[model samples]
Target chain A: MTTTAPARPAAGRSRRPSGRRAARWPAWRAFLLLTLPMVAGLFVFKYVAIGWGFLLSFNDARGTIALGDWNGLDNYRRLLGDPAFTRSLVTILLFTLFIVPVTFALSLGLAVLVNRLRRGRALFRTTFFIPAAVSYVVGALVWKMSLFSGTPSGVANSLAYLLGHDDAIGWVAAVDPPLYWIVLVTVRLWLQTGFYMILFLAGIQQIPAQLYEAARVDGAESEGRLFRHITWPMLRNTSVAVVLLLIINAFQAFDEFYNILASNLSGLGRADGRTPLIYLFQTALGEQNYGAGSAGAFVVTMLIVVFTLLQGRFAGFGRTAEEEG
Target chain B: MRRRHLGSYVAVIVFAVPFLLPFYLLIRNALMSKRELGSLDWHWWPETISFQGFADAFGNDAVPLAHALWNSALIATISAPLSTLLASMAGYALARIPVAASKPVFFFIIATMMVPGAATFIPTFVVVGSLGGVNTLWGLIVPGLFSAFAVLLFRGFYLRFPRELEDAGRVDGLGHLGLYGRLALPNSGALFASLGILSFIEHWNAFLWPLVIGQDPEFWTVQVALSTNLNQQAVNLPALFAGALVAILPLVALFLIAQRWIVRGVLLTGIKG
Candidate 1:
């Protein structure tokens, strides 16, 4: 997969061209030409639009580019007082806190299982990985209609009935806050853990086979002993990366919630349905309240940035202890 | 040691069951006729198997699902190659050429990784919408073609590439284009192919942008069409599964075809520093 890049050995040369010649071929001209399009196309799209959105948080319709009107900090002031917005923020926090740890634990356990597989390793890997390829629509549809559908005809409800729970509760329309959160987390875990398992497996494989051999020779018979001696320490960084990725993904989650709950939000019920992203979309696009949406987006972005930085700091991601060794 | 192998199989299967069962049920459900599907009772196996569901799905006139598949395949083929080519170009420059501003450029490129696509969706929609690209294939294909992640992968691959080949090319009086074509691209065909498959799968299975842009069924990608087809009031459960099955088949086939390299590439993301 590796490809050698073509070297321009003359790159460092200060080609001292005379007045007209220098004008014709600038020293930094080539670099500018090569990078400007990418910068203009991507950087402007990414950073500039984001910056504009941030500025729009403080602007009324005229001040913001999308829907023009100026009313400074009006959106922010309203956002600070908005109950639904506040609820979403709290819900997202609770959701992330719950989901990240669960997925981490799940991935770690699955990786350990895969690492132990003497055969059918590829089959197991493929089976888990297949769903990772399935689009959010398909996953959401299956989960909604088949897995957790409220109707008696649904698979989950049927199973629940079989298990002696006479109530075939509608998973999506459930009014209880905790129940809704559980459904969301379960679906997220089902979709996500496989990808993380692959990552964890990669980390597991990097733990030299010889170390496990040595552990076995030293009479490490139990799974706990094997993990303690040969697996856990090696997987620490992998775990960190997985946790960080999960946090980011969990915060950014929109599709599953959006699709699963597409039926319910007639604005009449409790708003636990809104993850911060969904809330932002609802407030801005659905409600035509762009200012509030921008504020929400900014808040979510800051929260994620802070969380990532804090996690990376603790993970020692930029430079790990092993790198020093 | 032999006992450990047996133990491993048991452990793997136990772990694999939860992930595998949903898919098992999905296929089982897909095969079941409407009478069986709508039944309140659940069974591991249906009393009979029929292609009724498949036929119902394929028979729909509103969605040119066959055309959606063609559109998806066409878009994927074009976008994957183009995106890979762009990534290779950027990757080559970042890895090979030593410019004064390369670090900053590389940093900027990598920083785009954290820019969530959801945040950009509205503005991107506006841009595409204004350009009259809405309900068009270019709307679907063009946006997905530009990926910072792909470029990063190519850059990582390039970083590991041997320098001697490029030097040898330079020794033979080849310029930048020749060096890339003759020395770099050929050596990296496996990576390119893997990348191609990855990008193709992503574009093929794409839902969000296509959904946002392709408002009409005529322009729908297979994925968008499948989901849209389902959202109607007259819920065609069997037809929905058939559409879904069609959409997933290409990706599964591609994965099977390129399983070795795809798995390796997947593994590489972690193992590579």
Candidate 2:
């Protein structure tokens, strides 16, 4: 909390000749001391490991990271040829398409509403944002075991009963109706929408109050027109960044899918619901087919980059904040 | 004017209900007794508010919450601060310190931002495995030591950092290292705490890595422990819910204490990225 500057020491230290030597400690040496560990660790953990994964993908090595036997395009070919992997890739694509827009709209809408509040902005923000603190595992457990549980005693079923639907619907297990998506989508919406809402709130706050006054003077009679001409256009960068992060997040969707659909009471039967990360998890870890798994890694990473680049191009992501204002 | 406020309040209520319902159910079910869990009638208040679920969970040996809590604390508390300190130093060096390789080094660190950890997680695990890091605390700690994101945040902060402070440090005959140790690090208390606390929560909540690597029960984090509870035979439904609530207790407390700072931190991560 303290923002004060460091106190000036007495003149005795500077007056000594030895103190001059300490001050003259080379910038190069300081650079080495500061960055060496971070750089080296990054090199080893991220770059080297990712590089090794690329290399490992080419090899016929099964159940081991040791090298020598090279399989070339076989791993890539295998993953692409397999319906499961392709389905995972497709699932993530559809998920991104489904989730990004819905979440984007929801968060922006929530931000606009919450920002409208004069009395309880913090209260509402905290109520929404509190879910963001919950882990997916815990969230999934609550969603599956309590709220969306198939039994008649569950929350959803109780609501349905009150609405005249006598039979309890198995929300997660019904593949024909694809009710699992509701469970998956709602839990994700609950957990993530709040964080993005906060971001949109920040972006909304940066729009000067005078802009609204100016628009009112210009005879902008309705909220819709004000939002369109002022708020929506002003939130371009924040929206782009939010979409980019959401796309990345959606692609990396394993935790909820696993806990909700895969782990607890059931095995993963629906290939359509399995995300790329879940597919990769099974390929590498479950089946111990690390090569195909490694191959899938590059594929997923490329999708994230391509989707982000495409969205960035559309949204004009590189504009300066001052230019946006 | 009154209508507008009321309309927004109603809209807020509409959003808040869906958001708040799960938490309410989680708490209610956690306190419900085992027999009550199976009751056909919906009990808004459990007939007998029972601690049986909690007792079953804590008293169960298969999924050990106590050990997992210790492991999670050790991993988060240690790695988060270490990562924050390193990020600050690297950030300071990039922004403030004059070095020939600053631009290239900064670019190199920035390049890694595009690659999500979820992508190369297995590969990273394989590397950690090769280095004998599997199932050990070192495995969890080492891979996450240097955060490029945190470093980027620090570099931004330091770029906008007032030059007079560094100049004053120089006037005091402080070396570059001394200036960093004394002036730069000390001045960044909020940044350190904000980033560190966020990272701490992430580490604590981390499931995938811990689940994959922690094959041995002794190495379980609370998440893995909770997941492990699912597959265990004769599932204690009430106990499972209780365990879920317990797992979130520390996080809930941390969040309540530092919610304002957390939002600011989230705002930074959102807009900056």
Q: CA lDDT of each candidate?
A: 0.71, 0.85
Error of 1 at B167 (Å): 2.1
User: For residues B1-273, what per-residue lDDT tens digits would candidate 2 score against the true structure?
Assistant: 899999999999998998988878878888999899988878897887999999998988878878887898899889889999999999998877654577778878878998987887978987898999888988877887878999999988987788798889989998878989999999998888888888888898888888777878899988888877765656688899898888888888888899877887888778888
- Please give me the total number of clashing residue pairs in predicted model 1: 8
Candidate 1 lDDT, tens digit per residue, A1-325?
A: 2132223323323432435444333424544554455556565556665666666666664222464566777887788788887887887788899999998898788777876776677888887776766777777777777777777877778877889999778877887644656567877787778778888888788777788788888889787988886688777777777887788778877767766776222443257667777776566545655566667777777788899889978877454433332
Number of the top candidate by TM-score? 2
Alpha carbon deviation, residue A269, candidate 2 (Å): 5.2
The candidate scoring highest on DockQ is 2
Indicate the worst ten consecutive residues by lDDT in candidate 2 chain A: A1-10
Give a tens-digit lDDT track for model 1, residues B48-88: 98678788777788877887888888888899888777777
Q: Model 1: which residue pairs collide? A: A60-A69, A60-A71, A61-A68, A61-A69, A62-A68, A62-A69, A62-A70, A63-A69
User: What is the Å distance of residue A60 in model 1 from its true position?
Assistant: 3.0
